[model samples]
Target: MELGIFLLAAQFEAGDQGAVLTAALDAGCAAEVAGFGEAWIAEHHFVPYGVCPSAVTFAAMLLGRTDRLRVGTAISVLPNTHPVLLGEQTALLDQLSHGRFTLGIGRGGPWVDLEVFGGGLERYEEEGWAESVDLLMRWLTRRRVAADGPQYHFREVPVVPRPLTRPHPPVIVACTTPASAALAARQGLPMLLGMHADDTEKAEMIRTYDAAARACGRDPRGVPHAAAAVALVADSRTEAVRELRTALPKWLGLGLPAHQTLDGHPRTMRDPRTYTDYLCSIHPIGTPKECIARLRRTAEATGITRQLLFVEGAGTRERTLENIHRLGKEVLPHLQAD
Candidate 1:
């Protein structure tokens, strides 16, 4: 089992953005020293959901900071950027890292990302996501190619600075629906699933992906797929859950534009009891022992060997660091042993 840190780069504190970024970078370095295999950064714009606007730039910084940790974008939104530019930057990063970079691509949503970065809602609705991805893959793998897509068109051109990794670095897609999983399998690519999914959903998704891969003459079991979920490991379940109750609402509150608020108290800071209950029902939050049991069951049920632990969403700098240490030192070993 490989342990990966999902760096949210969350702006939990609105007062000091610089401190938040520094803490996130510090956590990345700490993760490398703590024996984590990979550190994945997320990209978000115009909100505190994630402060990092360019995951590629952050990945480059993290790769420079760490010696052994593999750095990847949790996802770099594809529809919003030019495939050729993305391919060029990714190739450069891969070369600099000595082939320690992985590319995770996705069509991000909640409607706003597309609305803002992707021109507008109308454009997003009519956009050809698959065609864009196909063009991207071509640009990454081939030396000379032309993009022939609804969104992009170009004459034959040579893409310079071929990736250090043969045939390009591993490319993974973030999958949420059955269609997305099938698309990944068809492309002979692995996937990244979210933590919100229950054991049953995870297993179902794996099955769906495997069947699709098989249909395409690809081996799904051999493909490396991973899942991410909120993680907060503490000395006691009470302490862990308490922290969760406080952090979750604030993070989820970014959905206020959709009229779906996590912490409804506009003036209040604390999350409501019902909100805490809802979070507990969805995420894996508890003491090390409890988290161990939960993770074990998830593995047993879903047969997933790789997981990205999300520790930065709702914790202070000290607490997040402590949880990461405990995860790598205590929780990881148990998971590996079992």
Candidate 2:
């Protein structure tokens, strides 16, 4: 029942932009103070919908503001970013945070985020994604790399500073599809999954991951596993959905070619506002009590070790913060280890 924040602005009406950013950051600090285990940021571009696209920067900002909360990116668009630079930025943050930073990666299947870079969903097929991730790992860990690929090329070069955490900080991947989860298992990274989906599907994904890890000659217990899903919590279900609707237009509007789009997932600002409605079909939204209950069910059914909460521009700032704090205090306790 670890708590994590997803950077989004679904509730522009709750307050002025400055206040909203403060609320989000404050929530992170509060979550840490409340004994929540970790906090994460997201990367999005080409629209005012997501102001914090540089998650590495955001993580750095939060490190000094809180103690003990493991900060990380919900996912960094790896294809468009230079792996060496990505490693350097996150590692530096890790050092600054006293080894409290982790890395999250998502090759978003949505089109809007995908088109920003030359690579797209097709590049993630079969050997494509595995190869790309493999290269990324090599660049992150090796002092000198001499590698070439269909999408990237590099000569002998060592990325500096490395990471304060030994063997690099823990890596998490967003894995929903069966194949994708299996891929994560193969790579031995934890995963993030949607909260509203059937637990049966999520369990199947975990099974696939276990099998993949076994095939890779690694013990399944040696790896960490996690799932991240979108959520907006409040005191009542009605209030939760009420706040969620505020950002629907922006979420629905995503789907455009932008400089930071990495995954093919629809963009929040590039397309018509109707796109947010489309996204609602996938995320988990409800009051604190109800959301907590549902999350517990997910944990029991899927056996997911951690739940990544993506609370972004989707709901009013006040309500979003309230739910986050309440969730840490009241909700998480219900989902704790027996």
Candidate 3:
């Protein structure tokens, strides 16, 4: 099994944005030192849910800071950016990092981000996502690319500094719904399942994706799908859960209500306390032994080998780092042995 940290760079308090960012970067370096294989960065705009506005840019900085740890965007919102420009950046990062970059793409929500980026709500709701992803795939896989779609119409241009990895660097799709899972399957790309989902939900999504991949003549068994889950390790389950319940709710409370929809759509944010309770029940928040059991069960149920753990549920940088190190030293070996 491959273990990695998922860095949201969330601001749990009302101060020091730079400190939050520094902590995220420090965690990425710690992942490498602790013998983890990868670190994924999240992107959010105008929300403390994730202060990092550009996951790819953050990934580049972390790549520069670490020697062996692979860095990837948990997702870079596809509809809000030009595919060609993103492809160019992805290619450069992959080449420079010696094929250690993974580009995870997603159709972000109908948020104010589309309006701010001039993409509009229509782009988020319509064919823009498929068109953009298609163009991006062409850019990564071919020597030159062109596009003529409702969202993009362009002349053929040569791909400069092609990705260093054969074919291209790994591309994973963030799947939150059946449609998204199908989209990834049709493209024969792996899926990145979110932390909010349970094993049953994730297994169903994998089934949806697998059936779609088969329909498209793509084998799904070989695809290395990744699952994200909240993680914290302490002396006992009580201590771990108590710490997360207190800190995660505060982070969620400060961050969730900040999202604004682009088209005046009604958006109901999850209740922070309730959501925190749900996460503690479903995720790996306990001693190392209990964490290992939870993760192994999730993997066995979902057939997911890649684990992307959200280590910041404890809120503070010190506790987050301790969780990461404990996970790497105590839990990872047993899970990997399985």
Candidates' RMSD to native: 4.1, 4.4, 0.9
Candidate lDDT scores, in order, read: 0.78, 0.67, 0.91
Q: Name the 10 consecutive residues with the lowest summed lDDT in model 2.
A: 252-261
lDDT of 1 by residue, 1-338 (tens): 77788987887656687887888888998998788899999987677767888888889999999999998898998766777788889889888899999999887654456545653433233246676667778878888988665677789999888888878788899888888898899888888987667778888999999999999898877688888877788778787877777876766665223321223323333344565565566555787788778777777788887889888845588887887898888888877776
Which residue pairs in candidate 1 collide?
none
For model 3, how does the per-residue alpha-carbon lDDT over 84-176 read when each residue is reduced to its tens digit? 899999999999999999999988898999989998765676367777878899899999888888888889889997998987889999999
Q: In what order do the candidates fall by TM-score, top score first?
A: 3, 1, 2
Q: Per-residue CA lDDT of candidate 2, range 245-320, in tens? A: 6655544444233334344343444343444443344445666667766777777787875777776634455656
**Candidate number with the higher TM-score (1 or 2):** 1
Descending-lDDT candidate ranking: 3, 1, 2
| Candidate with more favorable, higher lDDT: 2 or 3 | 3
lDDT of 3 at 172: 98
* Candidate 3: worst-modelled 10 consecutive residues by lDDT: 121-130
